[model samples]
Target chain A: MTPKKVTTTSGSVTGAASSFSWSKADTIRTSVAGVIVLGLLFWAYLLSSNTETGGRASFSLLIGLALGIVFERGRFCFFCIFRDSIESRKNNGFLSVITALAVGAIGYAIVFGMYLPDTSGEYLPPGAHIGPTSWVLAIAALAFGFGMALSGACISGHLYRIGQGSLRAIPALIGALIGFGLGFITWNTLYLRAIQEAPTLWLPHYIGYAGSLAVTLAALGVIAYYLLKSNTESAPEKVSGLAVLRSKFSPATTGALVGVIGTIAYMRIEPLGVTRQLSAISRKEFEKQSLLPETINGLDTLAGCVGIVTETISNNGWLVIGFVLASFAGALSANRFKFEIPTIRNSSTALFGGVLMGWGSMTALGCTVGVLLSSTQAFAISGWVFFLFAFLGVYLGIKAKVHTL
Target chain B: MSTKKISRVVALVASVALLSSITTAPSQAIPKNDTQTLVSADWLAKNINDPKIVVLEVSAEEGLYERGHINGAIKVSWTKELVDPVNRNILSQASFQKLARKAGIDNDSTVVFYGDNNNWFAAWGAWVFNIYGLNDVRLLNGGRTKWEKDGRPLTTAVSAPALGDVVAKKADASLRAFLPEVLKVAKKQQNTALVDIRSADEFSGKIFAAPGFQELAIRAGHIPGAINIPWKTAINADGTFKSTAEVRKIYANLGIDGKKPIIVYCRIGERASHTWFLLSQVLGYDVKVYDGSWTEYGNSVGVPISNPAGTVWGIA
Candidate 1:
């Protein structure tokens, strides 16, 4: 876990500066810190909320933190991992994401079954899919895939990288926001035919959580075997772009940790949805009267049309925000805070990207994290569709050579 | 060579000093009044009763306007009142004149707009007003629900003001989308993609909810050869648009030839208008939203139609 020193060349800055670089010892320490932070939050939630599910709450945060630490350390981002495979034909990162995803799906299925009280308990929140396929889902997945390539990151990356202060991450964030807004504007149409028409492919419905878990684990096993034996190879690095951020962290370690986070995210919150966190921000905006609610809600009701939404721990906004701050603290304590203003292209990308993301997230009903990871884990077909199309979109975007801005 | 060195040194010094001055000017400078375009509920809460201002509630629902609205605010039906049925795009100048007159809107009035949801339709109405040379209109960020949530002010009575004298200025053709213009873009084809920004069903002309829903059914499919890139795809789940990268992804998925023009459209044009804002104004696409959209083309006698989701529609 020794941190690898990296050299970066910035037009505006001189010397080989590293951001988020931590020694192996530093990573382990920060991960321990992550555990402590999660524990403290769990304690606070237990004390504050007068709910009987305190144990579940505590476990969820603990697992989520472990996952976050692993993810941060390994850089288990769908966009980055997926892009490595496509652009450079590097299979290691791609296989890592697939492996984590398989592990998560199976792990959640087993956990849900072992823990579920009954059939009704198996019912997941609206975008939390275990796998259902629909045209809308397909389109969204492809689009998400495309987004990852173009932006060079996914929703999760944008969220965590805020701590690293990567200027390009800002544009990516903005793009996500704008995508959500536009999604809201066009919700009515997508909902009526595409979203509504698509069948929910919930695992619990057919085989129960236990059976689903078994199948998921089996699938993961198969995938891991296939990936491990494949002829795919990692690209030779002239210099690691992430080397600066690689303190006690390496992509592999972070990837595995993210798997843990994904699991905890499911157990605690409804699921690990990065897009919904963004959605909550929009909802708050509507509530604040910054944007119109009824129109926005009615336009993209599928995205915003949560009927009888729980105001409890089901909301991931608090957790996402808390995790981000904790990440900042972790990087700072490790002496890995690189807070450089991004190049002009990077800044514009953030602004414009945020705006586009706001629009797209609204129309698509979720982002990569929200629909792709969370819902895919839940076995929703649409979730898969979103992931696939978004991936395609990202690929096309990258291929087209669109400037960052 | 010495002269060149002196110039470089002087340029370096001047640039440093200028950068320092700009950077040191303000870390938290409060923007001026004009700089603040969106006024929050707190601002409207305090200024609701101001004599110089007028509030208007524009919605499709009828009795809801009567049931509850900001006090002294007038009601305008976005579908019926704000737009001309024939054009189904921008309101006719003559119709706008009448509606403005009925709402007691003077050219100089500082009109604030809000509605049930964050004033989306209302904002659209306000935008129309602004485009028509009305500068005093502003959207109440978070709109009616926020106001009601905060218990700001409400009245069950709808205002009936004495009609004001508002004259008709010809429709700003520059601010509108017409068939001729669309046809021109359509002919260009690859350089231009018609974005039927309606729902996937509307674009595919499938899953009709009601029979004889003429407005909903005009021509059931999308434009003869346009891409069904709904405006909604631009936003996130929480009702905000996706970020710029997300947007490019959305468009790129739709096979949006960025080098070409993208024209977005919907049933009446309100939703498409938002897309127009995102694409042309925000993403900087050479984009135009078809304000007339389905309402006009679908109902048109000669326009074509399709059914059963054959072409690329929905998220793909």
Candidate 2:
């Protein structure tokens, strides 16, 4: 009897009459993806065995892997999320950010309680992303937001997108390097003028942890309410097992997972930040070329993603590596990997946007993930300021149609 | 005949002994110079390759030594390596001996200590080494900051020299002042100079500790009768110790003429170690570092404190 061929959504052809039949190309792709994933795991194992930074590096890598998968599966790009809400009036992605903030804030409260039981403004939790609230931070966040709109992605967005064969990420990252150098050059002046005496206010210090959590959740609820009200799309149908793995995850599920990952990352290694290693590399190169000031004037003492010049790969560096590779693996497995040749216009725009982002992140002491997500979770007032100004910047950029330019 | 021979021999022996005493007196009277306690960055750069000179980088900041340090320098953690982690005390004699031997320090080795943060921890390391009675211990003048500022070469290469056969002496009590002795001075029972080596804000009870520091006292103030002299005052902009005359004059202006027994302290003893180096090592004064410092003293119950700012714990 002749067998009928059936094409599956996963790009696999199955024989109807036969008990089990799969496409050879699909089988090869799946196998290669599995091998790549296993190789990444082995690399993480090697990193774990390092004597100096083994434990933290390993934890960071694993967290990055989880983040990569979530970012890919959930489409958790900051620019895309904002763009969806602004341009298309889709609020699911925006709601995801709200959910993430809510979940992460609770997780941070629990951790903060354990680390620093007394939040009476006397002591801050060690290694938390609490930065000074100042005009410089406002300007930085606005620039960063505009960069996100123009470049088609935030710093972390560019990172995960690179996995999906985005060639423009190269110029963007290179531009970021130059931007960081410039940031270093101008750091002393900005720091002395604005950031030197800025207040680093923590919500828990004033209202206690419970009150802070309530306020945070209430704020998130308000945002989620507006988002759901604006969303016109119908609810997605539920899928199970293998189909679930192949399909996009719901915003709620994605946000929950991201929150859990962030909490775990903080508990084990450090707060979620994608810019430390990048900034460190830039700072080191600038110092070598005599482009930076002798002293960065209180840069090292301030909290946030303070990058120190180092020859060895830091935990954050390992995290970035894992994020990129695991994202690549996820893309390959989902059949989403497609190499796009970069046009000159796109490349130049990406580079310019990346420069603004890099400079903004440096001046502000962190990017979206570091400042907005982590700092807000920690209940630092700086995070809220960044959030407000960044949204405004993106709104303005979208109105100006900079993304198209 | 016997009496005449004995008398003549006695006279000759007395003359020879007097001549030997005259010969050694001038050498003994010549005081120790700056080179004995401090080595310039230029001097270290020139002699960095010397085997007898064991360079040690003692930093409170993490990953600094691994990032880049003076070539062939040994990394020493001020928190972990220098102190007893379990007990709030300096490392045990056996542990210090082990550390010294592991770092290839010998009895005759010229140990040059340098570190980040203006050599605050490096001077602490020097103080610890002094307690253990290590001979030929010197601090790197200007430390890591000066070396980097001068565009000196740094390497990420870590040195692992052969094990040394050095032994650490029992900790010298004279070099370290405990709370009891400090209390006596605070109570005016002892005529001692108490130098509070913390910032003016800290000394005046305006703040419990410096920003970003976790270790702090519940009560914000300083010991009674202690004078506020920030440790940074002893160092130049380049992080090197000021000239002996300048340092002495600075202290003399504050009525600390090194005549009385001196006890120097800061928040965690590290900054005080810098001042301790200036007073005890450089100026040749009888000084002891109160290693327990404000963390211990201010936390102690019923201790006399002078809080000029009138700050209260958990209130403001």
Candidate 3:
């Protein structure tokens, strides 16, 4: 029997039937998504014109658009990246992270150098949290890593995934909100005892920009070497421009581009954050206000995922709205948007994991993006501390999954 | 005139002259030996019962005092009591006098302030007390954090002491910085120094305004030439004011001698007031609180602004 021909994104002629099936349904979905995006843009324009912060909100909306597009196209997510890297032995996912970090570090150094020259001893980045390094942060990171495994997506990942109609993420998001409240309830004791006096070590504070960059690059190089060593798959063939947009990006390409974009977002708007938005939703509903201490153990000193609660959507909130909208649009265009009610067990796992994520993020003062990426680029000890622990949690979670399966 | 009267008058005149000479020391703005500016946790615990010192806990958030506060310290919400609800500005003299009476402070009562966040709002309390012309207003050394950290006791008991006889004075212009005064300092850039006592982000214009609060300003930048010295720099890791020497050095290293006129501003002057307390009360610097701060300055049109991040007008 003759094999069916596939019009491949990588421009390769394949023998097996293609997994994706595009149809008139996808065309209708894409059109609706496009209209909604236009409506959102118009609404953003009107908002910016009326309110003083509307301009910022509008910018966040655009940022959301870019974030959604890249995330959907690249399939950028912690779980997928880590899973492919570890289990599938896919160098692409791991290479993407290394590239993104390397690029992000350079971008951060450039912006950091310009904004703060010899001022590190005096000035902290406005919204960036380079929280103190302590045992608490380490513990929190481990929980965060574990939570991501259970929940199936990091906070931001779930947000963008929602655009693609990922139903399991809904419970996870809800669980995260509960987790934030729990974190707030338990904050004072933990903060007063450990975080208040925790030693905050900044790489920039100790070593110059060049030194930090060198160390960051070296770490990435070592990881990349391992990620690529055992994999014998050759580089995928490149497609033309339009096909490229539809195709899933290689990890390195996605990582580098996202890194640059994330850096710009921090410099221009605010750091990429989602936990704060979740926390905000919790605060908006929890009218038993005063759940948070006014000072919050100097939590007010840093901004990310933590903020004053009001009805108005924060800048991060706007970014979140944009992310979901654009991702949905992107997914539909790529014929990838699908809605599914997850199984009871998987749904329960996502919800449980999400709660842990919320709790862990609050305890550590940020989620994956806020701590591991934004703060890491700032050379915060909290960033690295969270990263290592989260990685461990992810590893252990994956191991537990193998046992369960 | 009697010879004895002449001799007594002459003695008083001589003492005044000696006091003036001592105050003339350029290095020391106020007497170095004067320990009345700050009361330690132990000192406060000991003297809290004296009935003359009204310990007040000022917080930016509500219900903090109910959580756990310094014994005998009444909760003073910076938003509710200290500020005028209608204008969303500082309280008027009449309102301040009423607040003073509510706190059970008499004309001669010494006010010692304490609160959480290392007494961030407590310093604002001290500043408010000073504005009301309260004599001997002091901040609790190390605030409630140190007191709590050291296992000091906290009481949930509410105090409704006898009404205070204190008279509220008009807000002193010298202790406050108005737009005109700030503008003059920004333009002249001389004997006066403007201290942007906010986080580096606020100073750098990386963020237009503080998070949690509405963006009060359209522009994200500091007053032109204002130095970015965060208010926390005045604090110890334990949430207490650094030693006078350390604080003095902090300002001195920044070329701000307490002798020179200094203006400090933050988002809404709450945090700036903290710096004002440290500089004026603790280090005895001639510092003024620019209560309008970035909210006012950032919104003002045609005013020169310095944004280190070069972030402005929705552009990077």
Candidate 1 regions exceeding 4 Å error are A1-64, A114-127, A130-133, A203-256, A286-314, A333-335, A403-405, B1-316
Instruction: Considering the two chains of model 2, state its CAPRI-style docking category.
Output: incorrect
> A249-272 in candidate 2: lDDT tens per residue?
777777877888888777666789
TM-score of chain B of each: 0.63, 0.88, 0.85
Model 3 per-residue lDDT at B32: 28
**Fnat of each prediction?**
0.00, 0.00, 0.00
- In Å, residue B30's CA in model 1 sits off its true spot by 73
Tens digit per residue, CA lDDT, model 2, B152-206: 9887565666777788999999999999999999999999999998889999999
Candidate 2 regions exceeding 4 Å error are A1-22, B1-316
Q: What is the DockQ of each candidate?
A: 0.01, 0.02, 0.02
- TM-scores of the candidates are 0.45, 0.59, 0.56
Question: In the order shown, what is each candidate's alpha-carbon RMSD?
Answer: 25.1, 19.5, 22.5
